[model samples]
Target: MTQNKAAPQNSVETYTIYATSNKYNRPPPPSTVALHGMDLIGAPIDIRNHRFFHPPPSHLMSTTTDLIDKLKSSLAEALELYPPVAGIVEVNEKGEFYIAMNAENRLGTPFLVEIKDTPYVGDSETLSPRLDMLLPPSSSALAVKLTQFSCGT
Candidate 1:
C-alpha cells in the first residue's frame, strides 16, 4: 500500500523556523575560510570574480594610451599573482581598453583607469599607479606597498 502524505493545515505553522531565529547557534568563526575584505563594511575579504570598470582614451596612443598599456600589464601581472583572473584584456569599441573580467561585465568606470598593468619604472621616488616609481626594491618598501593598492577597488 502507498502512503499518502497529508498537506499541512497551515503554511508557516508546519515549520518552527527556530534555526533562522535567535535559537540558531551563532556560527563559529570562519576557520577554513578567513575573511579578508571586510575592513569595516563587511565586504568580502577577496572580491573573487568581481569586475570593476574604467574607460580608456578615444585614441589608443592619445594621452591615455600609456595609461591603457599600464592597465594591461598590471592586469596580466595581477593574474599571475591572483590566478583566478582567467580572462583577457579587452579594448572596447569606444577605444577604451579594459579587461573582459567576465563575459557580460567590463571592469573599471568611464575613464577611471585601474592600476593592474601600470608599473613603477622609476628614478625610484614614489609609486603612482599611473606614474613610474623611481625607487628600486632596496630603496623603498613603502613604495611597493602603496603601488600595490588597486586604484579602482
Candidate 2:
C-alpha cells in the first residue's frame, strides 16, 4: 500500500471541502489475495458505485459535523472487518495483479466531504456530467464522498 494524499484543490472552484483517508484502528491481519483470471480481465474497466442522500433539515443542520465524524469512524470500523477494502491492487514480479494487505502498509479508503452552497438538482438517473463531482477521484479499490447542499438536498 502507498501513502494516500489529497488531490490538489482547484482554486477556481469555490466549494469548501477536504479529503482524508479513514484507516482501520488496528492493522488488519496480513494477507494477499490473488485475482482470478476473470477479475484480471476486467481490471482495466472503470466501475463506479455512487450513492447520494437528502440533506438534513434546517433544525438538524447544526449536527453536520457530527454526522461526518460518525461516518468516518464507521468506515474505519468496516475496514477492520473487510480488510481487503483497505488494500491495493499491485502487480507482482510475474506481472500478475493481486490485492495486497499487511501491517506495514495500510492504504486506507479515501473519504471526502464537500459543502455546496447551492441546492443539488442533478438528475440522478441520467449520466449527467454534474453527478461526477460527487465521487472521489479514481482509486484501485474504494473511495467515498459526502456532499451536503445548503438548500437541504
Candidate 1 lDDT score at position 47: 20
User: Each candidate's lDDT (Cα)?
Assistant: 0.30, 0.58
lDDT of 1 by residue, 1-153 (tens): 999764323111111100112132443221122213332344213221223334444475454446555655554444333322332333445644332334233222211322333332333323222244242211211111112222322
The digit string of per-residue lDDT tens for model 2 on 25-82 reads: 4543667888888886532533455567775675775687777776777776776677
Clashing residue pairs, candidate 2? none
The estimated TM-scores of all candidates read 0.19, 0.65
By summed lDDT, the worst window of 10 consecutive residues in model 2 runs over: 10-19
Error of 1 at 136 (Å): 43
Q: After superposition, how far is residue 128 of candidate 2 from its true place, in Å?
A: 11
